[model samples]
Target: MRELAGRQDDEGHGRVLERAAEAIEQASGREVIPGGDGELAGELRYALAADVVLGATYTGTLPELHPGERLALVAVCALAAAMPGCVLGDLERELTLLAGELDQAVAAGRAATAAAASRA
Candidate 1:
């Protein structure tokens, strides 16, 4: 059961990374330059802010989260920090994806706890 939970967390983290990459790519139109200067800095800042806001909203909506969910959220924020651009469409998608993942994690955690309690 522990292993199963671990796998779920790992998968969730991977999804967050994957979605971040997709959002970044979409925002930059498949163009990601190296280093943080000028345009890069601006884009990075936008992405980081978006991530922070989205994560805060998620935590506010679901205050009761497991350690794994919190870790996943942090990973998502890190990924967002690496993203770029402030396109409204991409930002909306990013927020939507983050919220959806958070919801899924919370639901899974609740289900797991309920199942464990039932067994006990």
Candidate 2:
């Protein structure tokens, strides 16, 4: 949480990291999927939701994670930090594709208009 706060770009994924971190610390390695070979957004949401539920479960519910499990949790958190950039990059690609499609559509419409004008 302190590490996230000290970050210069603390938003988006950062918010998730801080929130997820709070839950991961209390969750077993198996309980948290981190990215789970799935979409970052979905995985992050799941981890956060699970965290909240587990947090509310009761006292002593979150026992100490084994050293290996703890390592996995740390890895999950680290991967989450990178997920935001990957998601943003995918969105940019989609936007670029959409723009190209729109350009083609506009060009076709202009050509149609010109053709109709010549006939008239």
Candidate 3:
């Protein structure tokens, strides 16, 4: 079970990296140079600020990334930071609903596991 969980974690991390690559490719199409001197650093500051304010969840992956991938994720967070308050509020509403659903699912899974263990 631990190995399965580890593989799932690895898959999630791989998906994040793959999405970052796609973002870089899209930026390239728009003629943005992700490796421009000091650009990534500047963008990363915004990302960090967003993470602090919004709990954007990028902190875990940022330190392990290369320059290009970091640039991509930071660029995304910067864009999110730039969004209007109304849009952010709408997103918050949606996230709240999803989080509630996830919580319920987790509770159900735990209850099911407990029952199985008691019967064993």
On TM-score, the leading prediction is 1
Once fitted onto the true fold, the runs of candidate 2 whose alpha carbons sit more than 4 angstroms away are 1-89
Ranking by lDDT: 1, 2, 3
Taken over the whole model, the C-alpha lDDT of each candidate is 0.42, 0.41, 0.36
**What does candidate 1 score on TM?**
0.31
RMSD of 1: 12.9
Name the lDDT value of residue 72 in candidate 2: 37
lDDT tens digits by residue: candidate 2, 1-120:
334223414244344445666544433233224334424455555655544222323343442222233333344444433443433356456434544553454355345445655666
Residue-level lDDT for 4 in candidate 1: 29
Q: For every model in order, what is the number of clashing pairs?
A: 0, 0, 0
The segments of candidate 1 whose C-alpha lies over 4 angstroms from its true place after superposition are: 1-89
Please tell me which model should have the higher lDDT, number 2 or number 3. 2
What is the C-alpha RMSD, rounded to one decimal, of candidate 3?
Answer: 15.4
